[model samples]
Target: MIKGAITGLGKMGISHAAILGAHPEVEMVAVCDASSLVLNAFNKFSSVKTYTDFEKMVESEKPEFVVIATPTKYHYPMVKYALERGVHVFCEKPFTLTASQGEELTELANQKGLVNQVGFHNHFIGTFRELKRLLSQNVLGEVFHFSGESYGPVVTKEKGGTWRSNPEEGGGCLYDYASHVINLIQEIIGRPEKIDGALLKSFYSKGVEDAVYSLLRLDNGLSGTLLVNWSDETYRKMSTSLTVQGKNGKIICDATEVKIYLKKAVPSEKLEKGWTIKYITDLALPVGFYLRGEEYSAQIDYFVDCISNGRKSEYNTFEQAAYTDKVIEMIVNHSKTN
Candidate 1:
């Protein structure tokens, strides 16, 4: 079995623990967190060793791979430490605070030939995956425009301060929410070459933005608008969707379904000339374990499989995530200038 450890016992961290624990080829060895209350429960209920210090847990357990689910502020140092020790890593999203930090870690991981993956779980979602496939086949030929959007109740009302309210600590809707959509756009469509305009608006938070609006141009010259708002009370939870229009047709995709409108029928794909819908049930692949979503478990399984097979994954690599970081930087800079 591949020995693994985890740092941070927050929502994402605990979720990772449950999924990795249930993985047939993975053995949970240790966990590190700053919460004594959480650690005390683990001590009583689980056999895995626990520690408050991440480096200490890594040194003592010597796990082959470690899941870094801590906040974005801790990512650079933690990922650097793990890669230096020749251990594989699976880290949560918004890879790093700056593009430079992400670039450094990407280079280090590549030099060490270690398996590394970021938690951009949307890529594992069935609907989005189908969207990527159809685009690859040029089903929507000569794309002209696109839009990526996400809305959630992360900060609906003004509240007391927390890590999320601090920009230095990777707080803000841009990092926490928009990063997901930006990564999706960069991967599914093309890398954005410039930020035409941007606006970071603050609604409830005093120090950070609750919404983001931007116009971006891709390397392929495809222009698009990004609209994200975390303070929208209408959304019980986060919802992200994408729409692309091309000469041949258009595609609208979200977590649950993908709707296509083709100007002409393609017998090869069995798609009709009009609207056709594909649900997640038909596209999602079965996994050994299920958690918040199959995408979560699917991402973990993909990382573990890459390590065991001595190969690198093309999806959600540190390099791809760094490009996402660069785009975020562009938006921030552009917003300030505007």
Candidate 2:
């Protein structure tokens, strides 16, 4: 079994620890956090060793893999340290504070030939994979435009205190959530040739933007729009939907479900004055085509599979994560100038 260590014991970190601890192929050897209180609590639930210092945990446990679930600002240094020690790494989303840092780390990992995976779990969902397959099959012929959004209330309501509400700490809806949306778009339609965007800091007490919107132009003559915000008072909702206009058919996909509409009419169907709607279910859709799973668990399992089998990973690595960082930078910069 591969030995694993987790750093940080906050919500994301604790979740990663629990998932890795339960996996049969992994042994949760050690956990580290700056807070003794958090470390003590985790020690009570499992036999894994605990440490208040990450360096101590790494020195003592000597784990084959390390999960860096700390805040975004800490990711670069921590990942660099782990890579230097020859340990495989699986880090949380928004891999680093800047695209340059992300690129440096990606190069280091490649040089060391280490297994590194970033946490963009939405890509693993059956629905998304099927959507990719359909797009590749030209089911959504001649892609035109697409849009996506992820909105919710500020996770922490305090003033200038929450890490997510601070720009220095990589807080904001764009880096935290929109990164996923952007990554998905990149995968489906490829990278954008130019990006224009706007940001608003209306809701949060902090100066960080709570809402962001961007319009992108792809090299293939396709355009896309994205809106992500943390100011919504409604239920926590994340929807990644795309509508592709094609010659033969149109494909629409969202978190809830997927549908494909053929533009051509059937011979037996009568013409209608208004728009006609037809729904068809096909075997092409994967079974259990829903978005409900412990994403952290799936991410870790994929990383482990990559290490053990020498297989290529489907998840984003430092290179893709860095590209995402660059896109985000462009969006934020555009937002400022506009």
> How much does each candidate deviate from the true structure in C-alpha RMSD?
0.7, 4.3
Q: Write the per-residue lDDT of candidate 2 for residues 218-310, one digit (tens) a residue.
A: 668788788777667684655556656677666566554566676654333342232333222332223221223534455667788888887
Task: Name the 10 consecutive residues with the lowest summed lDDT in model 1.
Answer: 156-165
Find the candidate with the highest lDDT and give its number: 1
| Superposition error at 328 for model 1 (Å) | 0.6
- State TM-scores per candidate: 0.99, 0.88
Q: Candidate 2: worst 10 consecutive residues by lDDT?
A: 282-291
**Leading candidate by TM-score:** 1
TM-score of 1: 0.99
Off by over 4 Å in 2: 155-158, 265-294
Q: Which sections of candidate 1 miss by over 4 Å? A: none
